[model samples]
Target: MTAMMDREAFEAALRQIGAERYHHLHPFQQMLQNGQLSREQVQAWALNRYYYQSQIPVKDSHILARLQTTELRREWRQRIIDHDGQEASEGQPAQRGGIEKWIALTDGVGLDRAYVESGAGILPGTRFAVDAYVHFVQEKTLLEAIASSLTELFSPNVIGTRVRGMLEHYDFISRETLAYFDKRPVQAKRDSDFALEYCLENARRPEEQEAVLNALRFKCHVLWAQLDALCFAYVAPGLTPADAWQPGTAEKENPRS
Candidate 1:
């Protein structure tokens, strides 16, 4: 049997997975961050990505259910709250959540909110990828589930580049439209730090560590696959699926326009 790696080495292995396989390196992502895509392309991206964003809390809920301790559950519950937001009550205003903020992003891009939320127009690939992730969280070991979230480790840099490039190059894009990203880097950092610590501490055996590493890799594939779907459907030959969202088909008034 292989010997287990030290905590530091295990952590380094996890980060290496992000360095090599994260979707930030995907071609579609590069085009996006570099402002190479057209408005329709960006709209497609936002519309499809809304599916993924909406699922964040669903996967987190699966993870929350499996957590054995109150402290762990408390920490995990915040993720759901962050994505789903709090309801308005007796004395407080309703705070917006990540999912709502994402809707605003799609709205900013001129997609009808009802259509975006309906998931009727999303690509088959997007639905499959996002659903696979939720199933992964539900079926995998808790250690693997937490390790999968380590993709957050690389997201801050991607968010920074995407926000800057979109604002500079896209006439249709505004900082307010991109508001979802403003809060994600901080939230991702906090969440990734906790997940990394959990995986490093709990994955004691060599096989367990391997499972943790593979979990991150699986997540990286999930993200990369989403981009691959986008690239196929929107870029190059642009063979959009028969029923998927077609640009200029079901759009709202561009607030920026």
Candidate 2:
């Protein structure tokens, strides 16, 4: 069996996972931040990323269902509403539902709404990694599932970097087009803070602490792999999956312009 880690060491390991494997370091993200991607490349990114955004509530619900404590479930359930929104009659839709805003991003990019929702054109890696995350939450011990979500602890910084970089680099992108990220940093902090406190208080042993740290690492890989797949498939050209989106399937020309 693996050796156990204390609280300090466990926290350090989680931070190290963010440092080493987060998508911020990926070359695709660097290209995006530096204004190197073409308009088509950005569109491809938005369309594929919609899949990830749509899956968040499903994963959160799975985690919530697994929580035995009423207090824990109550804490976890808000993340679902944050992403899915609890609109009654849906006049304008809720102000902060992440899913509706993600669709708006795809619309801004000029992708066909149906194409994005069908998920037929998403990369195999994106599907595999995202599904794996949901599965991990459903199948693993509830403690580990909550611990895996600690990726949100690092998300706010990434969201800031992405928003600023997207605006600075892409003249075609406006603040409005990128609105999906505006609320995420705050939401991520709120969700992750709750998850971190839950894990820290519940994981009483050195072994459990180590498992929690590893779970964070696994979640980091899950996020990183999605971007890496995008980089390899869309950025490089001719490397895209057989079923993934093409250069002009939804529309011809740079839709952003």
Candidate 3:
């Protein structure tokens, strides 16, 4: 059997998975960051990505439920709140959540919010990949589930590149429209720091450490698979699924343009 790695080595191994397999390296993401895709392609991306965005809190909720300690649950609860937002109180204004911000992004890209939320037109590949992620957290051990979230360790950099590229290259993309990303780097850092600490401390045995590493790899694949679906359906031969969203169909007037 393989020997257990020290905490430092195990953390390094986890980061290595993101370096090797994160979707930031995908061709579709590269084109997106470089301003190579067309307006319709960008719209398609926004619309489809909304599905993933909406499900993040759901995934986190599953993790929160499995946590045994109030301390852990309290930390995990912030993830759901970050995505779901808070309601207006007697004296305070409502805080916009990540999902609402993402909807605004879709609106900025000219997709009707209702249509995007309906999930009626997303690719089968996207649905399957995202659903798999949700199920993974629900079924896996708590350590593995938290380890899967280690993907966030790599997101701040990619978000920076994407935000810059879209603003520079796409006339239809605005910093306001892409607000969902602006706050993500900080949030991702906080969340990932906690998750990484949890994973390192919990994965005490060799087999457990290996499981943590594999969980991170699986998450990378989940993200990569979503981009693969986008590239295949939108960028290449463009054989969009019959039921999947078409470029011009169900679009609103692009005010940003």
The numbered model that scores best in lDDT is: 1
How many clashes show up in model 3?
0
The weakest ten consecutive residues by lDDT in model 1 span 248-257
Tens-place lDDT digits, model 3, residues 45-114: 8888899999999999999999999999999999999999999999999989999999999999888877
Evaluated at residue 108, the lDDT of candidate 1 is 93
lDDT, residue 170, model 2: 81
lDDT of 1 at 69: 97
- Candidate 3 whole-model C-alpha lDDT, 0 to 1: 0.91
Candidate 1 per-residue lDDT, tens place, 47-148, comes to 999999999999999999999999999999999999998999999999889999999999998999999999999999999999999999999999999988
TM-score, model 3 to reference: 0.97
Cα RMSD of all models vs. native, in order, equals 1.4, 2.6, 1.3
Instruction: For model 3, state the Cα shift of residue 105 in Å.
Output: 0.5
lDDT of 2: 0.83
Alpha-carbon local distance difference test for all models: 0.92, 0.83, 0.91
